[model samples]
Target: MLKAGEELDMRINELKKYDTITIDNLKEIIDTHLFLTNVFSDISGHNNRSLASKYLHFHVPNMFYIFDSRAIQGAKSYVMSDKQLRASLAPFGDKEYIELVIRLFTFQEHVKSQFGMTVTPRVIDSFLLNY
Candidate 1:
């Protein structure tokens, strides 16, 4: 536990160097998230992607999208229903959290184009959670 905490601290300090999340830096952010997720998964012997996302989201609420079962299911349902949205997102890879961030970015654009309302990660999260 102590070792994991120290590692998490070190990684988070590195992450703190980024002032904001943007397309240019998103890959690096996801790499950090994967690192944290793997650290927890190593300790718990189970996948911890959601927990890692939530932790990072808590620290940088505006930057990281909160990944939970409900949101993931909602994203699947939504994409399945909208061919355009599904087509807009690139094919998923082993790192699903990266795909989720890309989906959120595409969704943000979709909402703006369809409804003229600019949405944030938090708003998208609420929509997904409630969907």
Candidate 2:
């Protein structure tokens, strides 16, 4: 989710406007979610302490909160028309939804493996059909 309720360009510009990020400033972000800093560590591959502090600013700056529904619809609309939206909203063209289904398929494979059950396309197709 986008914590900053603005375009990515605006977010970058805002950071450039500020020379440095301080420790006291990050306290408020941690107050809501302590594990927030760790989320960016793996992606940036930054060292623990120093990198974490910088990652925290990149993820969520002081006083900047997440807007759950960002300008995603607007961005998509500019790229695609209203007719395309109606067609794509249905499961077929939805990459995110398709990825979710594939993830669930993997989860099912793990659960079956635990029971010594072999996974096959037929089984997955059946499960998808039943659901």
Candidate 3:
């Protein structure tokens, strides 16, 4: 849990920079701040994937996905099930997280190519959720 004002403001301000950051820059941010790894440190115990992803998605919607158990399950069966996905997810980090992001980006491009740009990340997420 973040503190009342200054801490929250700082976090929000920090997150704003991620909106246009590249994958490598994102990795550095994650490494430096432990954005996902140390999320919910105040109240929620330790590394919580759901909360982490939700927090990241709230800040960087176009780049991050809300990766909960359901999303992972759906992705395993419907999107990525290869050895690479397994290896990437087995030990989650900046590299693996960015890999997942790239996979989603690729899938979004494929969806756009197949069904036109009418499809958005939400649409793809809906499909993944239902799948």
User: Judged by TM-score relative to the true structure, which candidate is superior, 2 or 3?
Assistant: 3
Candidate 3, after superposition: displacement of residue 129 in Å? 1.8
TM-scores for every predicted model: 0.70, 0.23, 0.56
Which 10-residue window of candidate 2 scores lowest in summed lDDT?
A: 63-72
**Tens-digit lDDT track for model 2 on 13-93?**
544453322223222222222233333444565423323334434454432221111222322322332334334333332
- Model 2, position 28, has a per-residue lDDT of 29
Q: lDDT: which candidate is best?
A: 1
What TM-score does prediction 2 earn? 0.23
Cα lDDT of all candidates, in order? Answer: 0.70, 0.35, 0.53
Candidate 3 clash pair list: none
Task: Give the C-alpha miss distance for residue 114 in model 1, angstroms.
Answer: 5.7
Tens digit of per-residue lDDT, candidate 1, span 23-92: 5656556766777787777888988888888897887666678887787787766653334533433332
Indicate which candidate wins on TM-score.
Answer: 1
Report RMSD (Å) for each prediction in the order shown. 4.6, 18.7, 5.0
lDDT value, residue 75 of candidate 3? 56
